[model samples]
Target: MTSGAPSDWYRWIPEQISARDYELLPEDFCRTIEVVDGHIVKCESPSRLHNRVARRIATHMEAGRKPEPCLMVDTDVDVRISDVPLSLRRPDVIVYRCLDDDAKLYAGDTVLVVEVVSPDSSFHTDTVEKKAAYAAAGIPVYLIVFLTEAADGIELIEEYRLSEGRYHLVCLHTRRLTVDSPIPVDIAFGDLASG
Candidate 1:
């Protein structure tokens, strides 16, 4: 199905799409939708401000990362979380600690996954479902950067750490925060995004 068609058509992949099928999808498919639970879910891109926030955080994380071999990459890459429903979720940014020269990486290599909350219904999925997915994937860190007005018109950063197959809220910051888990980094939302 193409983007022009209704989302229902992409909802569930009965036979599961192959790479060629994925390629047949419209050019905007990668930017607008992702497969989740064997269904295609639209992922509305956040505002330019959100992109700046994500980039800043990624840059800071890259600079502050310990000498470990991980690389902080701007997201938009597919990450397989499960096989039962053929779940594939793409985060806004990811810090992956690679074990070898292979390019594609999944939860095993993902040290941290971040999502900048958008204003649409995706907010629910981002906060609830995605959190659970990341935890179950055994990702060590998950960070949600809130920018939507319902978030009180103020920038909010919530960081969760995976523990015992669950995500525990480890810290919350309104302006700026520093994290030492999965990696060590200082994120100043005010200093970066606000500017």
Candidate 2:
């Protein structure tokens, strides 16, 4: 009912949430939380360092993106993967090859989806359930940027590409090791981690 009540909204399916009901949600909740398969999943906000890195990446990519455009950077937007009668999820960052001008509630298919890993988030679900969901939804690229440790720790990046009805890890690298994906874009972990 109300965000403060903390009812079991997680148990609902996408079809269960009506357009009218979704509008009743709280306005000022700190972290991003979404309902998927009736489960309430909380998303992590970028740390000052994480925000800096994301901005840097966006800037670099923005400079290189051409004609067709690789993707549009949405900081924190709600995306509807499926809606039947119950659940939903608003990922941290969604990169779409095409930006929707009229979209207010949510957008359609996205090319790449990225989530800067947060220690507070339920890593198992994000890395497992949501990953599978994105893959099933046929998202071309999924990037998980790890920013969970203290002491300015390791920045692990894993890039997954969908193929043959599933997602496979195409590349993996740490901040100490700079690596490029077989895809068109090159992400420098070392460069991103510092920012």
Candidate 3:
């Protein structure tokens, strides 16, 4: 995990296995899996609340985008953390400049990436490591919607922007998030937990 590799969780799975190989595995009963640093990392299934929040944020973003430059889906893509690293990550949501239908979207084309902290999962992976990875890949904006163990359900939303090959905190809010870079966005965290 120091330089190029992560934890040895999948140490026995072999180092040369590709993403295709991970896909061919006989199905994981519970977890969502991805190949990171040539290791198969299993992510815990997101709780219904977690998914609901993510969906609301996505919906809100779609509703709030404006007319200057049409921010399209740019196609859902598996982003490589870096050109040399073998990380293929699927962010919860991503948006960028609208391009041809057939164009393949890469990290360089990303304008924003959102990650919602899952209630049933360890939120560690979404913090520094993934944010660093995304920043390292030159993605402009990164947002993390925190859904922690709090009485109100939604905890806080943290926004980070890439600056000088690294990410720096722009703002943190508990009720709402408004971002104006890479594409404007206004989201209400309270709406996410409401039925």
Best by lDDT: 1
Query: In model 3, which runs have C-alpha deviations exceeding 4 angstroms?
Result: 1-14, 19-31, 74-77, 82-85, 100-103, 149-152
Which lDDT value does model 1 have at 188? 60
42-82 in candidate 2: lDDT tens per residue?
55555776676566555555545565544566656666676
RMSD of each: 4.7, 5.2, 6.6
**lDDT on C-alpha atoms for all candidate structures:** 0.73, 0.61, 0.69
TM-score of 1: 0.79
Better of 2 and 3 by TM-score: 3
Arranged by TM-score with the best first, the candidates are 1, 3, 2
> Which residue pairs in candidate 3 collide?
none
- Evaluated at residue 173, the lDDT of candidate 3 is 78
Cα lDDT tens digits for candidate 1, 1-195: 464444654454345654445545655655677777666677776787777777777777777766656565556677777655667788888888754544556777788898888755468888999998899899988999888443333368898988999999989977776887666777565655764
> Where is model 1 more than 4 Å wrong at Cα?
1-28, 99-102, 148-154
Q: What is the alpha-carbon lDDT of model 3 when measured against the actual structure?
A: 0.69
By lDDT, the better pick of 1 and 2 is 1
Candidate 2 lowest-lDDT run of ten: 175-184
